[model samples]
Target: MALTYLRHQLHLHRHKIIGFFLLALLSSGQQTLAQGKLKGENLPGYEHKRLRWGFSLGVNASWYQLEHSELYVEAIKSNPDFSVNEKTGIGFNVNFISSYRLSPDFVLRAQPGVGYHSRAIEYKGMPADDDNGIAGGDVTQEMNTFAGELPLLVKYESKRRKNSQMYFIAGVKPSLVVGGQKKGSEYLQVKSLDFAVEYGVGLDMFYPFFKFAPEIRYSRGISNIHKPSPGMFNNSIQQLNTNTITLYLNFE
Candidate 1:
C-alpha cells in the first residue's frame, strides 16, 4: 500500500521536474530567437569582472534507497503480509555563493549552505496515518538530518544569447550533521557524516542589476548510513542510499 502511494507521488514530482526544465527551455529559446533581431547585449559587460558573489535559495525533494535483508524476507514469511515503502520529503536549500571567473566559458564556484533534509520509510501494517507508530493504516517512521553542506563546483556556460545563457555544473559536496530527531516512537540511527558528487544544469538570465540562474541538480549518496542492530526493524534494511533533487534560484 505504501509502495503504491510512493509511486503516485513519484509520478507527480517527475512532472514538476519536467515543468521546470520546460520553462527554462522556453525562456532560453525566446532569448535565443530575440538575438537574431536585436544587436545590443542584454546586460552589457556583466561577466568581465574577475570575481563575483551571490546567494541562492531553493526547494528540494529527498529520497532514500532501501535494500531488504535476508532476515527481512524470512520475517515477512513468519509474520502477516507486510512490505516497506519509501517516500520523498520536501525540503529547502539556502546557499552563499562565491565564484571566480576562470574564463569566458568556465567559472569556479563554491556553494556552502545549510539544507533541511528528511525522509520517511514506512512499514506497512498500521491502522491510521497518524503517529500511532506503524501499527495498521500507513504508519511511517520519519528521520531528519540537519546538516551543513559545502559543495565545490565548476560551472560551464554556453555562449551568451541576448543576455541569456545555459550552463552545467559538477562538484563534490561533503556534510556533517549538526542535529537530527526521530519525530515518532520508532528510531533509526543514521550516521552523522555524508559525502556525494553533485551535478546539474542551469539557465542564466542577466538583468540590468543582477544575474539570475534557475538551476536543477541531483546528488547521490555513496555512504551506507545503517549500523548493526538486533531488531526486525533495523535488521530489515541492508543498505541505505541518499538521493536529492533540488531546484535553485540564484541571484548575483
Candidate 2:
C-alpha cells in the first residue's frame, strides 16, 4: 500500500516537478551565458584549493512515505472508510559547508546543518469511539521537529566553461531529532534517528570574489521512522519514511 500510494503521487506530479527543475536549469544557463561571455575566467584558482568553507540556505517541501500495518485490515473493518494520508509541508535549513578537493572533477563535502519542519499525518473515517477519544471522524496531527543533519557527499563536476560549471552530488545524510515530541499519548510517535540518501544537481557560477551555486536536491529516507504509540492513527501505520525536496542557495 505504501509503495502504491507513493507511485501514484509521483505519477501525478512528476511532470510538474521535472519541468520546474528544467526551467530553473535553463534560466541559470541563460544567466551564465549572458555574463560569462563578457567576463574573463573568474577565480581561476578557486577550484584547485585543497580545502574550502561555505554555507547554504535552503527551503524544502517534506512529506512522509507511509506503509500500512498488518492491523490495517482490522482498522478497515472497524471503520469502513479508514485511511491514512500525509500532507506536505514547507521547511527551511541552514548548513555550514566544508569541502575538500579530491581532483579537478571530484570533491568531497560535509554539510552539517539544522532543519526546521512541520508535517502532518491525517486520518480519515475514524470511528467516534476511537482510541484517544476525540469524537474522531477525520483527525490531523502535526509533527514539528528540529533536526541536526550531517551529510557527507561526493560532488562530480563538469569541466569549467569560462565562468560556469555544472555538477552532480550524491551522498548519505544522518539526522538526529534534536527537538520534537519523541513519544506521546495523543500523537503518532517518530524515532529520533534517521538515515537517508541524497542526490542533486547544481550550477556553479563563478564571480570575482565568490562562487555561487543554485542546487535542487532530493532526500529519500532509508530507515523506517515510525514508533508505535497508543493511538489508532499510529496503530494503522507500520512504516513511516521521509521525503524531502530542497532548493539551496550556496556561497563559497
With a 3 Å backbone cut-off (N, CA, C), the pairs that clash in candidate 2 are none
lDDT of 1 at 203: 83
How does candidate 2 fare on TM-score?
0.89
What clash pairs does model 1 have?
Answer: 125-135, 125-136, 126-135, 126-136, 126-137, 127-136, 127-137
Tell me the tens digit of each residue's lDDT in model 1 across 1-252.
343355456664545754765576567657755754565566687866689999999877787888888877876786556677677676778999999999989999999999988677877752222342433444566766678999999999898777787899999899888877543235565677888889999888777678888888889888887655544456678888888888888999
What is the lDDT for 196 in model 1? 85
Model 1 regions more than 4 Å off: 1-40, 126-138, 183-185
Full-model lDDT, candidate 2: 0.84
Per-residue CA lDDT of model 2 for 1-252, tens digit only, reads 343254346653534644665677678779988999798999997878999999999877678889988887777886679888887666789999999999888999999999976677888886654557657788887777899999999999998889988999999999999996645556788998999999999999999999999898999999999988776767889999999888888899
| Model 2 CA lDDT for position 159 | 86
Report the C-alpha displacement of residue 37, candidate 2, in angstroms. Answer: 1.7
Clashes counted in candidate 1 amount to 7
For candidate 1, the per-residue lDDT at 119 reads: 76
User: If scored against the real structure, what TM-score would every candidate get?
Assistant: 0.81, 0.89
| lDDT of model 1, residue 186 | 51
